[model samples]
Target: MASPGIFSEVRDPSERVRQLCNYACKVDIDEAIPPKRYLRSGLEMMRMAKVYQEEGNYESAFILYTKFISLFVEKLPKHPDFKTAPQADVSAIKKKVVASFASAEKIKAKLKERYTAIEKKRQEEEKRIQEELARKQAEEEARRKEIEELEECKRQEAETKWLEEQEARLQELKRQEVERQRQQEAAAAAAVAAAAAGINSGAPPNFLNNQIPSAPPGNLSYIPNDFGGSTKLVDIDSQPAGTGPIIPDRDLKKNLLINDGPSVSSPLPSVDRTTKPPAYDHFMSTGSSSGNKFGLRDVIIPSDLPRKFLVKAEHNTLKNIETCGILAGKLRHDAFVITHLILPKQSGTSDTCVAEDEEDLFLYQEPRDLITLGWIHTHPSQTAFLSSVDMHNQYGYQAMLPEAIAIVCSPKFNETGIFSLSIERGLVEIGSCRQKGFHQHNKTPPLFEDSSHAKTVDTEKIEVADLR
Candidate 1:
């Protein structure tokens, strides 16, 4: 559909006014109008325009002012009554039209100033939000870097301490080796001195009485002697006090071999176990055991919801007109709970109801942090089921929240039911179907069904706002 006017969305007030004037000049006016009727209509229109201006409705006032000036200044000159009117009346009308034109100019300037200020404030707000986000991201990055540096420092310190311990072990092993060799050399010299004394005294060599000193107390290994089949102790070291028996040389070397790479001392990355997947908790709740496996949380409705909505729609029901209301609520304890029913300003027929001024509805819900769970509408004379229009509307709600449900009240039929699209088939079919208004769908696999995830609770009260 075309716009109501060519200048409707134009941002520049002067340009918009120029376009409107051009369009108005082309509009045909009734030439048979009486002078008194014209004057009366102009007075009423000007009065209304002043009222709109005083109420801070500058756009409406500007449009009215423009229309008034256009009719009097552009079209009135062609009117037969305007030509034959008294000279004084014509001059008065001309003066008023000129005054109205001036008023329109002032209104246009005011509108431009108002819109410019609004745009400036909006831009500033957006800039502030972007700066805040950037500041937070910078702080987070700094923190992440600090954590990494701290972990690196700790890992390096651990590796350095390990190297120092290994160095100390090597020094102790070298000292023990030197002590063992010195003891062996002293024992061998004493044995040779005793044998020389025995030869000088001419007595039988008392090798058994002056025996050589035993080597060490640790696990011993012997080497073959050149003199016959006898064996002699080679290198050995005593066990350190209080430590378990010394490891053998071969086993000790194997244990001391460095690994292929340094062992890392950094901790494993932290996991946020508290964070739950967006909507999984709802379907995984104990109450949602019977629903389809789409993992949507159960929705709790007030038991008195149907009765309260019916009472709100009583006037429309009696007149055989449909009444619709938005269902709004909050998520609590892993479930969506209906807390408010908002009836927006609307017009309805027997089978259709359209809520208007939806921005007003958003304004009302925003401050309270309300979620649009779904909607409730009366069927009036029809049965309690969703029409094609309702299906499309519900699609939007469900898209916002998979568990959203539509409630239909049929006062004449004494029926009330809560419903949702069949996730397995209905949601897809209705989402893809483009036909608007009341229409038919395949009944073989029903397009909608009773919502298994929604149940009524009598424990809480549901608030109502009749914006109408």
Candidate 2:
């Protein structure tokens, strides 16, 4: 360290202190503030360092920089009181430190270029002000020009619209003329085909045709099966034992399966009025040309279902929660009997849940030899609607058994709704939809077991057996 030559020479204490720092630390200060204290404000140290470096005194600048780095940039953050200081303030100090660390020659060039930059900015500001004044004057000139252009554009638009209207009218008339000619040609072709058929059958085509006129709109109670086509109803009991398999009626949509013998003479099947056969729900499908699709045409719950299961579901419903139970039983005669109601273990909130112990529940059913028919659950709201999760679960059940159904009981609304995937529309849509969680479905599917037809099992025949 250099010796302080001002060893009691200056009368003012501030001046003496400045001399001491200048001599000992190679730093000069305008005031007598301590070097360490000045460096405490990192920005102040940076300004002092720049001043020293620009003035060709590199030693003082580097010393001040070393003090600034040690005190503010690094050590201050580790102190408990300053640990939580603003990050932005710390970053600003860092940037200044980086700028001050430049070489002496680099610092001189940057400082000299700064004055030139300020002058350039002043000139730019003056130029911008002049351009704004010029633009205000030009706006008046453009006003008249814009009005002339606008008038010319309006005239062009009017002319274009008139031409378009005329073209559209001509095209419509041409289409009507083409349609008139097509209808006349079709009538002539039909007349020729009818006359040829009359000659071949030796009778008028309309007379030989067994087609009946459709009923008036007021008389349409139910659409006769096969759209009013004359059909000889075929009953299974009426078929003779030794005869070949019953030939399916044409509109039955069954495959053209021929028997192993010679062809039959009459295509008409025998009809028996005494048979009380089950009525089946049917639809016309065209996606597949051969084979008819059948679902459980209708499901009839006895007017006497056990009340215990309903009692439990009603309890959960009142509390605005949910509960699920399974309906399983043996296939008695031609229908399913609800002999058991097993409430399985599950975890869910008011909206959704997963049924666990399904494998075990199903395994137990295997020993009892009962078929898993359908499932029933209660909703807090009376809407009795299926959420997207409900649909996915139904998809698995429906896939396993085509006749499987979903029953939703909304005790709040006193609503019980039954739903099934429409083999044509419902099953195809639900089976194809792979989305999960709450999602949108197109429409409510047709139900094989509707709430309106959910007959209560007679109390006399009702019995409760919990297999939970």
The lDDT values for all models are 0.67, 0.50
Off by over 4 Å in 2: 1-300, 304-306, 444-456, 459-468
Worst 10 residues of 1 by lDDT: 281-290
- Predicted candidate 1, C-alpha RMSD: 18.5
How does candidate 1 score on lDDT? 0.67
Q: Could you give candidate 2's per-residue lDDT for residues 1-468 as a string of tens digits?
A: 111112233334344334433332322221222222222235534544555555544334444555454555454545554544556666666676666545433533443354345446756986896687567557645754565666566656654554354345445544544565466566656766776778898976663453333321221112233444333333324644432122223343222222233322323443533211112221110011111135141234544442465686666666677788776665432234556667777766687756687656655665565555567787876468677678767765555444556787776776777766556666567666767688877764542324332234554243444444
What's the CA RMSD for each of the models?
18.5, 44.8
- Cα error, residue 194 of model 2, in Å, equals 90
- Write one digit per residue (lDDT tens) for candidate 1, span 1-468: 111223334545566556544543443343333554454445545554565567566654566577667667766677876766666656666777888888888977876776566556767987997797778778767777777777666666665565455445545665765577588778778888878988999977777877776654453222222223233222223445322222222222234334343333433443532212222321112112223455565689999988999999999999999999999887554457889999999999999999988768867975676767789999999899887888888876664456889999999899998999887778778877878788888877788889887878899789999999
Candidate 2 lDDT score relative to the true structure: 0.50
